[model samples]
Target chain A: MVLFPGSNCEHDVVAAIEGLGGTAELVWHGDRSLHGVDVVVLPGGFAHGDYLRPGAIARFSPVMAAVTDHAAAGGVVIGICNGFQVLAEAGLLPGALQKNRGLKFLCRTVELRVETARSALTTEVPVGTILHVPINHFEGNYTCSPETLAELRADERVVFRYVDNPNGSIDDIAGICSTGRNVVGLMPHPERACDELTGSADGRPLLRSLLTAGLATRPA
Target chain B: MKFPVLVEVKLREGIADPQGATIERALPALGFAGVEGVRVGKAIRFMVEAPDETAARALVTKLCERFLTNPVIEDADITVG
Candidate 1:
């Protein structure tokens, strides 16, 4: 996982992965290498004080060059919440996240319907599977041009859609994958939902899917 | 030459401005009238060093396009002096 200065969810993601019997590590934002990790995760938090905009300053962090290289090499990259904003700002993903429709910071569990099972993030789950995930953000409303939206829909790159449209995201989109299908950005934090003791373990399948995908591409 | 640059960033038309709308909603309660189309944005000010005004404007415009604003949802209007 990549750890920006203000990133608070790195530990949560590491704990979640470890609980599922997977190993994880943290790479500082200033570090320029991913250390050959097959899967790169940009955890959620207010990086760089969310200066200028959420994820804006973080996109220029030295480690992002390495992240971009990893993505371009077909490695799996996942960005959750503020990480999603970073990916968008870095041009790793399409569209941008603006302020939520109600101008309120939402922190709650939301139902996310898996729209497709072909991408790395959802390959282990069946389509239409509803995963209860927690989202915490003040600017999670996803926006994209009409052309890009049509392209995303036609290409079946939209991996998840909100069942209730909590933040007024266009097309009720909660997650999407890149054309290569190896990169994903989503507003919800699956790491926060990995334990039944916390609330739900629906996030396990998603993380498991990611780990499985990573194993497939691991250098043996 | 040092030029003072002002960049006004606004959400593109047709995009929802909830912050502006929320502020507008409270206006009627305050007995203010004749208010509509409330939208919110930000102003960014900086200084750029260039040989000429044209060069300064171009430099600032590049900054606006690449860093100062997100063109997907916001447009940046630049004023250089």
Candidate 2:
């Protein structure tokens, strides 16, 4: 896991992953290497105080160089919420996360339908499976050029779609994967919903799927 | 030399800006009529340690495009002095 200065969700993600029998550690943004980690997670938060824009400054962090290298090698990278913005700014993902359509900071649980089972993040999730996850953001509305949207669809990059269209994202896109299916970015916080005590356990399957993916790539 | 630069980023035309519209709607009720085409944007001011104005402008434009603004949904207006 990568921890940008303002990141508050690293521990949450760590706990979730650890609870699922996965060893996770935080890699500071100032660091310039992944140290041979298989999965790099960019947890959600107001990185670099969200100055200029969300993920704008964090995208230039030294660790990102290693992240790009890792992803290019087909390593799995998951960016959640503000992490998603970082991925977009880093050019690892297409489209931009602009202000929500209603211009309000939305914090609520939303239904997300698994769109593609091809990506590492959704491989264990059956297509059309609905997961109730919580999203908290002011700039979570995803927008892209028409051509990019067409490409995303044609390439099977979209992985999740909102069931009720909470933030007015184009095509109700809630999450998407990279062309290689190794990188996934989403607005919802799966970590927050991983336990039943938190009101929902829909996130379990997603995290388990990631764990399954990681195990597959584990060196023999 | 140090040059001052201003970069304004606004949502491209045809993109809905509910924040601007909400403010515009509030203006009419506050007796400020005839307000139309309200759009919200971000203004960024910074100083660049470039050798010349042209260099500063070029640097600032690059910054605007690469980081200060997301060209996918925004248009940037940059000025250097």
Candidate 3:
């Protein structure tokens, strides 16, 4: 887990990963290395107090240097919620997360549909499968240039889309992977939905899917 | 020399701006009429230390593209004084 100073979801993500029989370690934003980790996750929260913008400040964090290198090496990187914003700001992903169309901080459970099963983040989940997850953010509406949107469509990089379009995101995109399909960024908080009592257990397959991908990338 | 920079960031022309629309709708209810094409944007002020005005302008422009605004969906107007 990559822990930005203001990130509040690191523990939640760590707990979820542990619950799924996966070991997780929190790496501070100032850290200069990934410690040879298999996968890197940028969890949710108001990083750098969301100053200037949600992820603008956090993108410049030292740990991001290692994260960038990891992604370049085809290592798995999943950026959730605020983490997604950081990835977009860092140019690791296309487009930007603009303020919600309603201009309010929305916190609620939402339904996401798997749009493509080509990414490691969603490969276990069959296409068109709907997963219940929670999203909490004031800026989760994703926007990209027309050219980039076309490229995403052509490459089939959109991994997930909202079932009901909660945040006015273009094409109802909830998650997307990079061209190489190793890096994924999404708005919904799958970690928040790992439990049956609190949220939903639908997030299990998604998290497990990452473990499978990590195992593949593990130095053998 | 050090120059004060003002960066104004606005959403792209075609993007849906609900906040701006909401404010526009409120204007007529407040007895203000004929206010059309209302849009909302953000202004950021900072100091830039550069060698000359041309360099300062170039720096601000780069900042606008790199950090101050999302070039994909927004445009930034930068002024150095």
The CA lDDT of each predicted structure is 0.93, 0.91, 0.91
User: Top model by DockQ, which number?
Assistant: 1
* TM-score per candidate: 0.98, 0.96, 0.96
How many clashes in each structure? 0, 0, 0
Lowest summed lDDT across 10 adjacent residues in model 2 chain A is found at A211-220
Q: Residue A211: error of model 2 in Å?
A: 1.3
Q: CA lDDT of A75 in candidate 3?
A: 92
Cα lDDT, model 3, residue A26: 92
Number of the top-ranking candidate, with lDDT as the measure: 1
Reference contacts reproduced by model 3: 0.78
Question: Model 1 over residues A1-220: C-alpha lDDT tens digits?
Answer: 9999999999999999998899999999999999989899999999998999999899999999999998998899999999999999999999999999888899999999999998888989999899999999999999999999999999999999999998989999999999999999999999989888999999999999999989886767
Clashing pairs in 1: none
What lDDT tens digits, residue by residue, belong to model 3 across residues A161-209? 9989888999999889999899999999999889899959898899999
Error of 1 at A48 (Å): 0.6
- Residue range B6-39, candidate 2, lDDT tens digits: 8889989988898898999899789999999999
